[model samples]
Target: MANIRPYKISISESQIQDLKTRLSLSKFPDELDNAGWDMGAPLADIKRLTRHWESSYSWKTAEAELNSLPHFITDIQCDGFQPLAIHFVHIRSKVQNAIPLLWIHGWPGHFWEGVKIMKPLTEGDGVEHPAFDLVVPSLPNFAFSEGTKERGFALAQYAETLNKLMLKLGYNEYVTQGGDWGTHISRALAHLYPQTCKATHLSMDAANPPSFLANPVLTLQHMLTPYSKREREGQSRTEWFTKEGRGYNLEQSTKPQTLGYALVDSPVACLSWIYEKLHDWTDNYPWTDDEVCTWVSIYWFSVAGPAASTRIYYETHHTTRTPENPRAVPRDMLRAYSPGVKLGYSHFPMDLVVLPSTWVRTLGNVVFERDHEDGGHFAAWERPGELVKDLRDMFGKKGGAFGCVKGANGYSQ
Candidate 1:
């Protein structure tokens, strides 16, 4: 058993100086006239951001704000992999029977994504809403957590590390909330350890159309029902992503190392790469300069170099490519339904992969579903109140997953 120790964020003065130096020496590429986001992150935007990052940004202030949160580090050892030092933010509710929820983050995102909802989730109004004990982990190789040296650390390993951490914290059974890569990871946790992961709530809905052979009832329903207005619009959005927005996926999946050099060497390269998604993936969320820099700074000062984060794409893509590991969860299984665990889905209009309600139903035993006119991939950060509300309603007294976790009804006696 690894001891859990209190942790704080304190980047050294030399690191801060080095970042400023890199920002000062950045070389930018020229763009065609009037080429906005169509040609990638605009030269003007990157230059302005680089200037601010070099001069005005205060990492010390950001560090102090992050330190105020309840941060901790623990060792989580997955089978065949060495013990990894996992960094996380754990907040226990005053309500004794609060639900234990594991919140995981995806690429280009860290534990800070959940900071907005932490207080509201744990300190819910006693009568109407439900409170929760939240456990947000910086997935290994993403942020402060230590990275893996060996190969084959795919989705299963990621799921295993999180499940063990929950068990180590005495959360014998729990629910989850996540988006982006998080959607896949939470589903993997439920599939691998159904007894421990009782339910999951997701923002991203990536599923294949129902098949007549495997999903007779769902296929029949799909044939009978015409697409709703929202569903029709969602298809157009999905088409746009498949055609225009998926270059990063192919690059990361096939040749992340080639691109890793740019991300590791240039601060602007890292910023522009992430900033583009933060712009396109969201539903017009206005981002400040400091906000963008702070988000990128986590990657700049990540425990593992920024390059390590992209390996998940390659590893997961090749997970079941060999014949020996036939049972390993592949791309298809990630979209397939896993019985036993309850599910909740939140659909956002601007998310990269937006599927219809029927398609999403094929993923699990879905009990709660909601569609929002706005918001996008970064659901928790863009719309914390809405995301938190979905969780509360899913686990509240009248929810489908009510009483799923023993004694964690999220109410006061």
Candidate 2:
């Protein structure tokens, strides 16, 4: 059993003062006239946000609101790595046999992303929509969790840590839900520990084009079928991301340390980097200054420091540079089929990478899929109700992944 202890968001007064001090002295960058969002996060918006962060945004109040949830810390050590003080929100359902659902978040996101759907997913009427025991973790090197000093703590290590955490918590078998890095991590979990990770519900998806040698039928189907309006739009969206929106990805993947100096040293540098994603990633979801501050604050004041979060991009990409590489098997297999775990996906039209149904089906035994007309990258945060509904429908008695976890049918006594 793991030695678990209760945890809280305890940013020191001095830390808060330092953050404010940085915000006060931030240097503003000039923007070209009529540049709009194409250039980046608007100068006016970042300036206003920086001012609000320095003045009106209360870290104490934000910390209290976050502390209201059940937070716990435990040491989870992966192979060849030192123990990480993993921070997670473990909320159990009243339903005795509720499904254990591990919600993994991606970059520019933390455990806070699951806050909106946590209670709703746990407090459901068991018969109508099965309840879940949610475990939302701050991945090693993010938020309040400790960072790893080793060179190669990639996806497999991440999957190992979470799997060990679940088993330590007495959940030998469980399902998963995630997007962004969450999607990749959950896929890693399924690929590596298929017997332990029974099923997965993903909000974001990435897949290689089906080849004649690998998926002849899928390729033929794709070739014959004309893309639907949504699929066409999704392709355009994907292209836009590939061409215009990938600068951050390239920098983070190839040379994170170069950018790390900026992230760790300047509060405004961190804010502008992430705030741009908040604006562009979502489908016109109006962001409050407070909301933006809290999101960025989690990164700014993260236990490992904001710079640690960016290394995941570098490590994962470098370790899995080639498909033949065995060190990171999930990188290749994530897009390939997984026979052991059941799969479900929620496709938000405006998500970063959206593909036609055939291309996605190559990943696994996809038992459920829902295509949303709206919403974007942050499915849980932006459209909690819809994301929750999709979960229920996917895991309900009539749905595909029902009773996947042994002895936990996601029902009340």
Candidate 3:
């Protein structure tokens, strides 16, 4: 597995030039008159982003910033075959009190999402705060990691890979925090490896109901609540996407070969697809045009586009994540008014998670629950300090229970 050929970014001046050329020449879609994002990625906004991407963006600068941290690549046996190598960033907190913390990003963002919190977390912001030896990994194929050849890349698939990553690095025990898909991964990890994965936390820890949560009247009440706004508006913008946002997913699960062509061939197309989501999903806080472009540019240079993200989507929808064997560890859940942004962006259909508490109860122990005054979908990227601070406090408490094997009662089964 160590011999799985290492791969780093190889974007050249010429490749950047060609990417710019394509962005400059690409034909855009016809819009409804006076239509803006109500149609999807307003033409004017897309043009503005395209112009900046073509003229002023520099991949080299971003590459250096990314390389400032330590990075490595290695393969973890997913099952029978030697799949694509996992690219990860490991930043160890020098503080003697540091707790082992592993952060995961799902779709939309890459390992880059967790970069902001690295220094403040590990460097010990204050005088005597314990540092966190961080293990931030790019989910297989989202950014720098290689694509998997497995049939589907679901939460279970990721859980398997992560288990190997921890053991490979001699981390028999660790703590995890995540938001979107990362949140799901955390749950799966806790359920699958309750012993090694000491505790789990999620910003979106809503569970699916037996079918009553979708009753017409109850669903209507959820829609009006502004909390489920994003999904509601998401469905309106992209008619097909609202049905679980499965357009790209279908291709990834069935014909990844065909989907890879468009993503690989047109760099601009990939950016347009992914960048729009960052804007559409988040509550649209702590992100500006420049930051948004930076995230998208990373993908362009890394060339870890449509294929990898699609695999995540394919793997998630196809995997067996839901089970009766309830999670045994404690969980901390934060609901950061994410639904409002999804609704305000456009009228897309949303799976409004009305009661995250009741939902999370099905999976595992939920110790802490707070509706964060700030942040939305990408909490780590949007509010790194707060997210890291919460993690530190939570992990600090977990450290207090270092030797205790069972979760404190009244948490979860």
Candidate 2: tens digits of C-alpha lDDT, residues 1-413:
44999998899999999999999999987889898998998999989999999999998999999999999999999878899999999999998889999999999999998899999999977878899999999999999999999998999889999999999889999999999999999888888899999999999968888889989999999999998777889988999998899999999999999999999999999999999999899999999999999999999999999999999898888775355445474356677788889999999999998899888888888999988899999999999999999999988888899888987875623
On TM-score, who's better, 2 or 3?
2
What is the C-alpha local distance difference test score of candidate 2? 0.91
**Which residue pairs come into collision in candidate 2?**
none
| lDDT at position 354, candidate 1 | 81
Worst 10 residues of 2 by lDDT: 321-330
lDDT of 1 at 407: 76
Single out the weakest 10-residue window by summed lDDT for candidate 1: 321-330
Ranking by lDDT: 2, 1, 3
Q: Evaluate model 1: give its lDDT.
A: 0.90
What candidate 1 gets wrong by more than 4 Å, as runs, is 321-327
Q: How far in Å is the alpha carbon of 227 misplaced in model 1?
A: 1.8
Task: Give the whole-model CA lDDT for all candidates, comma-separated.
Answer: 0.90, 0.91, 0.60
**Which candidate number maximizes lDDT?**
2
TM-score computed on alpha carbons, candidate 3: 0.76
